[model samples]
Target: MSSIRARLLAALLAGMTVVTLLGTYAIYVNARDAVDELFDYQLRQLALSLRDQAVHHSFAPPAETVAEDFDFVIQVWNPDGVRVYFSQPHRTLPGLAQLGYASITTPDAEWRVFATRLGESIIQVAQPMRVRNAMALNAATRVLVPAFVLLPVLSLLIWLIVGKGLSPLKKLARAVSRRGAQALDPLPVARVPEEVLPVVCALNDLLARLDAALTAQRAFVADAAHELRTPIAALQLQVQLIERAGCEEERAAATTDLKAGVRRASRAVQQLLILARQGSDAESPTLQDFDLGELARSVITGHSVLAAEKAIDLGYTGHEGEVLHLRADAAALQVLLENLVGNAIRYTQRGGRVDVAATRRPAGNIVLEVSDNGPGIPPAERERVFDRFYRGTTAEEPGSGLGLAIVRAIAERHRAKLELDDSEMGGLRVRLTFPMPEHPPASP
Candidate 1:
């Protein structure tokens, strides 16, 4: 669970350290070679000076003096090949031939030698290899020490720079941490990086969904409480009356009230259950092809009792030529039709007309219409008619106000359109228009 900055810094430091080490090694080798060249130049120049002194000035030093004065061993051989002057008289150090640069070794130690002719003799200057190597090692150390100190400083600077570069991320994390659980406002994206724009956009979308869900939950609770309390209170009052009954007659009266209360409570409970089912999940099974006209006819037949009681004529009146094939949940379609027809029957006056019709329009739409010769909805209030618990202008009817809302919900589920318009019989019209199937079978 290492942080990104930590990981990046670790990698950066590792790379820098490796590169610094390699560069340091290269610098060290260069320094060593530079020191070696200096030593060789000094050796060559000393041999030339000694040669000039012997040939021109004849300033020869005694063997003991020469050994003490000179920092290195020296050898002089006469033209006849006899050793004339030699430092380190006991043991002669290894010597090189004339002309080019060379090095020689002896049983005791190794030496870098330079030989030149001095008139009648050869003067050879040989310095011990130990002195030259010590100088090179010192030079290499001088180059390595500064590099070691500078690498750590450079790595620290890089780490700080990386931290500064990632400061925006730290701010974002802090901003998110400080938000309340119920807060669903969009994240502050003004200063966010383009690299993180997609994440911010996704978070904003999630917040919007969460806000919608919370609003729905609140509305549901309020609506349930408001709807359930009425029936529950009615039931309570009815039970109290039954408890206070003085005789059979009084008890009979209480029993009637009790029955009405029970019915109301039962209806409220049913509406609640329907609302619950109508929740976000479209648990309705896959839509099956069904006859809209036949379904409308069946609903009209079922509600004939209401029409009869109200003295209204309930009948279907549209083209009965072909089956009204539509893709929708059959049971839901039946419920929708039943509600529309029943409501029409209940609202119509005695001897009024209630007509159910299903027809396929030329534009390839199936329209299901239920109308009555009763008071129609006002233009201003038609929109609210689809809200749950929204009793319309005709509130005297026994309804949970959920019928039209359920109709709307089902219509949406089927991707159909429901409109309220003037009926042909001059009353309210509830029409559900569904899209025709892509391919329709011709009438037999």
Candidate 2:
């Protein structure tokens, strides 16, 4: 039952056996019925022939050898019930015959008798029931014998046909089993059966995705190694400088630079972690409606100390009230704003003006901008600045070069567009455009 071939063969054989038995029994029953009708008809004819002969003569014709064996028995009885003529003499059959045809049974056997009245006598013909039944069974067996013989051959043919039909499935399984660990290439679907085509296609899609993921993972590891090497080497050199310094002032200067290098390396690693997390599985972003102006104000306030340390004026503009809001990831957008503002403050000269602004466009889109009067990136290096660890020629400040890269990653995660332009404050302006949600709810 566990094997499909066995189950199919068993079911087929059992059905064939049952049908054969039923048909054979039907044939036998029909044959026996036909035999009964034929023999009864013979008995009637014999009785009439005897009556005609008795009318023409006084006795029956000579009995044949078949009449003496399993043939019909004939008798003539007078009106007074005295035996007159006998074809095969029998004592157990009644001395008298009943009118018409009837079955007469005695202790010895059962007989089918047909009788008719002649001019002055009655002629009767009778045959045994057992003999008629045997004749019918013999006829049925002769016809059904060949069919029973072919049953086994036909069953084997069915088993072979079913096994051949399933060969393609076995081939597919073998092909999959022989693949190696690095074989993330898609499986072929061209020769696959239509019934299994969907399964093969889904597997191919999964393999393609897996291959792309492994490639990205390898690149990430290599990039991380290369980026970490510089800060670690700088830390080691700073440590050596501190160890070799003889005066207290020299030791303090080296220690300060060492701590700064440590801070920069830690910041780079943190940004790398953020970029990796944002690049993965970006289908359903955690989105909710929040005020863009409020977030801008908070970011500017957080950078105020840094702005003051350089004597720069950091302020917000164009955001009178909460008209600009978007459905986006709050934490990711917050990180994006922090990176933009922090980078602007870091690169700007002392006393330079930095402006953070939020404005709603005529098309109902929200635009957020962080602009500064710092020596901004050249037009040639503007696009490259977004690349991971790609610093500009004008960038002389101490930075890990991951700030804009992190900003770009977070902006992409929120489905926002980032563009670089010249600021009115005579520096770079990083503009982010957030599209208005279709079918947005009424503003509160």
Candidate 3:
């Protein structure tokens, strides 16, 4: 059962054997019937042939004999019930006189008898039943003898045919087994049968997906290592500067710079961990109906103090009472909004206006945007801002460059669209458009 070849071969042979047995039995039965008819005809002809002989009182016994000591017996009984002629002298077929064909049982065997009444004699002719049975068995044997030799040959042919039909699967398995663990390439499907093509296609899809995931993981690891190295080395140098300072003034100054460096390195490590976690499980399904307007307001409030420190105007301008809804993982959506609004606050200059808005437009799309009237990314560099560790030409602030990349990942998770364009407020507009909610928002 563990081997497909053994399983199929056993099933085929078992079914064929059953059919062959039933067929042979049918053939033997039909042939026996035909043989019986042939012998019966011979009996009738022999009886007819002896009719032209003279009517006699005594008969010379037949010179030849068979198993019953006679092949056939002839008797003529006159009208007075006296036996006039008998073909076998010693053996007799015992029965009351029957005018037509009848079975007459004797001491040695049964006989097939045909009796008829002529003008002055009762003509009786009989043959042994054993002889009829022997001829029938011989005929049935002749018809069935070839099948006995043919059964083994037919079984061999069936086995070869089944193996030929399954050879492609064997080749496919061997090809797969030859692959190294690092090889994540798709399997070949062109030479496979139509029945197996779907399985191969599914396996290829799995391999392609696994390969993409592994490649992304490697890239993330390398980029994170490179990004963390700079700040960590700076922190180490700052720590040495603090420890080796010659006076209190110099030591105090070094301590402040070292703490600042620690903050920067800590912030960078935090951002990298966030990016890695999000990338590791990009599409974890935790969907629920939530108000996007409420979420936008919450995110903007968290960054209000940061905006205040820069003397930048930060506020939410969404509709007061209406809910803009969506079904998605709330944690991912929160991260996305924080990145957008935090970047807007961090890069904007003093007195620059930054406004966060969640709106349901006339086209049934829910749009969330953070607009800042500050120096923004140039049109030529807008697309590259989403790449990890990429900074625009105009960027002068100390920051990790994973903000927009994380935003893009979250947008993709929600099937939302992210776009950057020149704001009507005379700076950059970072907009994320989500499709209409799948279900109505909860009553608040």
Candidate 3 per-residue lDDT, tens place, 314-389, comes to 9998888787767888888898889888888888888889999989889888888899998988999999999999
- Pick out the ten consecutive residues of candidate 1 with the lowest summed lDDT: 54-63
Model 1 segments more than 4 A misplaced: 1-181, 195-199, 279-285, 436-444
Q: Model 2, 23: alpha-carbon shift in Å?
A: 22
**For each candidate, how many residue pairs have backbone atoms clashing (under 3 Å)?**
0, 0, 0
Stronger candidate by lDDT (1 vs 3):
3
Model 3 clashing residue pairs (backbone):
none
User: What TM-score do all the candidates reach, one by one?
Assistant: 0.58, 0.61, 0.67
Candidate 2: which pairs clash?
Answer: none
The C-alpha local distance difference test score for the whole of candidate 3 amounts to 0.81
Rank by lDDT (best first): 2, 3, 1
lDDT of the candidates, in the order given: 0.78, 0.83, 0.81
Q: Write the per-residue lDDT of candidate 1 for residues 231-257, one digit (tens) a residue.
A: 788878878988999998998998998
| Total clashes in model 1, counting residue pairs 3 or more apart in sequence or in different chains | 0
For model 1, what is the error of residue 349's alpha carbon versus the real structure, in angstroms, after optimal superposition?
2.0
- Superior candidate under TM-score, 1 versus 3: 3
Predicted structure 3, TM vs. truth: 0.67
